[model samples]
Target chain A: MILAATPGTATLLVELGVILVGLALLGRVAARFGLPSIPLYLVAGLVVGEGGVVELVTARTFIESGAQIGVILLLLLLGLEYTGEELTDALRDHAPAGGVDLALNFTPGLLLGLVLGWDVRAALLLGGITYISSSGIIAKLLADLGNTGNRETPVVLAILVAEDLFMALYLPLMAGLLIGGDALDIGLEVTAAIVAVVTALGLAVRYGDRISQVVFVRSDENLILSLLGLALLVAGIAEHLQASAAVGAFLVGIALNGPAEHAARTVLSPLRDLFAAMFFAFFGLQINPTDLPPVLAIAVALALVTAATKLATGWWSARQVGIDPPGRLRAGATLIARGEFSIVIAGIAVAEGIEDDIGPLAAAYVLILAVGGPLIARAVEPLTRRFSQLGRPARPRRTPTARGTTVS
Target chain B: MTEINETKLPGVGTLHDFESQSGGRIGVIAHHADRREVVIYDSADPDRVSEGVTLTAEEARTLADLLGGTSVTKRLDDLRQEISGLAIDWLPISSNSPYVGKTIGETELRTRTGVSVVALVRGDQPLPAPGPDDELRAGDTAVVVGTAEGIDAATELLTARAR
Candidate 1:
């Protein structure tokens, strides 16, 4: 009767229902296709977004908020997977090689940005995107290969840790730069953010177990609510403080310990997955399909150069540890993927109204490597192995286990 | 057991990890005398926990049964042999177990195996020192105390097909 006269909640509900159902079906298809569902989700976003098939007039606002949650949860889950203690120790141990890694892998993007005649900030953003590798894809490759006992894994891990540690330090700095303050203001903001993060980290390291004891309760509902609520609260505060909500959520995740950590992860993973999908879609939604064709050539060429540089970074780092040539090759191949962090950097930059080209370029570059990374990693083993065999028989090395890196 | 690393958490417990056949680390927290928690690390990120499963002493036995393969598992018997003298073990009664729907007294578990039911665990709740008059439900864990021989007998009796 009056449904036609006024905009009702039913329209929003129906749209959301349709979108969610579509996402589920796409997720299943992606699983079957052995893709990460990220690409599929991105495509879905592009199709549903502006200048595409269907424009959702009602659900756009809902999606925008969901995307923010997605980014926060993505970083939070990642942080929960890694702890503060891990980061500090990794940074301390791998500083020199990590330095080499930064110099080599990061140079391509910076040089490319300069060549393309972008401003310093955008160039830096581009460089940041190029420097970081995708831990998510590499991790999956490691698991799929079931070659966990390989000699090169620890070396690869050291490099990954170094990258992760760098991101933790670099993200707050980037966020401050995005705020467009003068030198002193930027420095002060960055310092405050770093100090806050470090203090929070120190507290987590010292009082994590005790915090867990307090957070856990007899009821599952209370446990999840408290953990999610705390993460959101930290993220909000971090955003207000200009520390980046991702960092805040991540810190909250790393801070949780013991029984609460396990329970919280179990409860929060579904929500994280949901939001993470939305985040990817939102990223895709921002990119105009028309802009993609022009960026395609640069994206492919940049991916190739970065892929080579990443290989060089891995080769040099693993070589520093005296790994065999084949192991070095494997290490190089494994580090090729660039997924979450690159997109995140671009997202933050775009949010600050940086060059529009940055987003489409990043989205294109990530799409290339996230798909190609796995294929290359899979092929590298046999490729390197057979090549090594052609030269001479090699003995399996019994290397000492990596120190301070007990997976447990 | 070779210790990969040890951390002493003052009020909580001592955490010990071991290097598995794979490069990943597995850890156990020996908490409050008898309680233990098993931890598995994320292979890709050694700093974070991939999984942490906290099982009570009662639930752990049910886990033992599951990991033991089938009910009449050779490994479970070998596990009992490790505990000399008076031994305690948890035996699971599946949905279709012969002893289901009968009182502990009627099942004559003690009569057959010379083992006493120390407790009965149903889900998270453990009924300590379960009386013989208590009914044995499906998916119940019978916590029996006995010698290795008695446990083997109980294991056989619990898993046998219905009469």
Candidate 2:
């Protein structure tokens, strides 16, 4: 009966179906290779996007927004991993390491931006893009590699939480700096964003348990719809307030606890999986494949330099926690991947007409690392063990044995 | 060996489809909080759930323990401590309790109750050999090694208000 509708509607349905089917096939292929599906999804988007083999005639707008939702969901899920108190504890314990992370990993891109002779604002944008790690990619990598319980993981996560805290601050400041004129306007915008973030976080910490109870319903459908609606509403409000929508979603996550948190995670995973793939693909869609080739060399060079810096940050952070050398290396290797946030930064820059080359450059850089990071993380374990054997004895060794027998 | 495939059900559980050695596919949906559902699938169409049953958290743990061994579940393992004379229990430090932000030593658990704080599970990280100075954060599960009477005393000591 629905097929009896207009040709335009039919076309829309057909395209959506085709894209989802394509993504599923690519995901299966990614499984075969034992690599992350993100790279494959990106390639799929490249093939189907503008300038690729088949340029889609319709549904770009819908896919684009879905991609935004994907980013919000990614950050939200990451926040659900810990309580506000734990985050606060981590902030206190790992503040110095977080500083180390920002200095080492963030400096390269800032320098590169200056070298490229972009404005101070653009350089800062690039630096922000480079500084934050992709929580989504790291989560997938941990699950795939079965490295969740590794001794270095807590250190890695601590660093990530610190990064998230920084991101909440940096994103608003960047947006303000990018948009406003003069010092006072910039200060006002940044201060307002920070206040909004703090208020949201405080409210979440205080009333989260109550909010979670109110949201949960006996029926599965109601619970899913309610959580989704709540996330969107909060994200929309945060966006309007000139803060990060993702930070808003993340706060919502931090507010929920115990059974509700687990329930939400279970309910949200499928939607997250679907939207997140599109988010990756949508990023690829924005890039011109032809433009990427020229910037490819520079992008790879940036990735190589930053990868090492990220590894250094990880190694330093993990070593500070007294994890053995091998675990330290693994920590460093895992942080190498950069995904959605970098692309988001580049997308904003392109939208604001900050710099023309950055969009393509960021695309190439992300592509290189998103694929390379996991590969290096997986390959590093044996290599590190071998090298550690050659070197002097380090701290007491801790081996990762999975804590529980999970059927799924 | 049990062959398992899974479909994650939103707000409900992860429905794991296990292929039995008899070539039958049975499904078990492990709920996030405290419930696990078992459903029989049709032999012809493994996707079609034929019959269903549900178990509470304790019931599920007991079932797993019965089928496998004592160490089948983490909570159960914590319940049935491997220590010979030293009984262990992962006592949750309740929120709003006075012990929420004090250290093991400050709580004076060992001195007052002769209980050794063996480990502390904060979120998922198990800090084995938690030191005297390790600050007890909210929601921490303190693994205490002591006799039954000593454990009751230690629990009282930790939750007791400052004099």
Q: Which residue pairs collide, candidate 2?
A: none
**Colliding residue pairs in candidate 1:** none
Taken over the whole model, the C-alpha lDDT of each candidate is 0.76, 0.78
Top-DockQ structure, candidate number: 2
Q: In model 1, where do residues sit more than 4 Å from their true spots?
A: A1-8, A394-408, B1-163
> Of the true interface contacts, what fraction does each candidate have?
0.00, 0.02
Residue by residue across A307-353, what tens digits does model 2's lDDT show?
A: 99999999898889787677788889999888777766776776678
lDDT of 1 by residue, A1-408 (tens): 665545547888887787788889998996675666666777777777776577676887888899999888877776666555656665666677788889987888888888889877888889989999877667667656643334455567667777866776678877877787689998998899888888887887778778778888868898878888888999999889988888888777777766777677778889988888888777777777778889999999999999988888888877776766777888888888888788888888777777878888888898898878777877886777566656554445666779987745
Error at A87, model 1, angstroms? 2.4
Per residue, candidate 1 scores C-alpha lDDT tens digits across B26-140 of 7766553345667775444343344666668777677767767375454343444345598888788887788898999997878888999989989889999888799989988
DockQ (CA atoms), all models: 0.03, 0.04
Candidate number achieving the greatest TM-score relative to the actual structure: 2
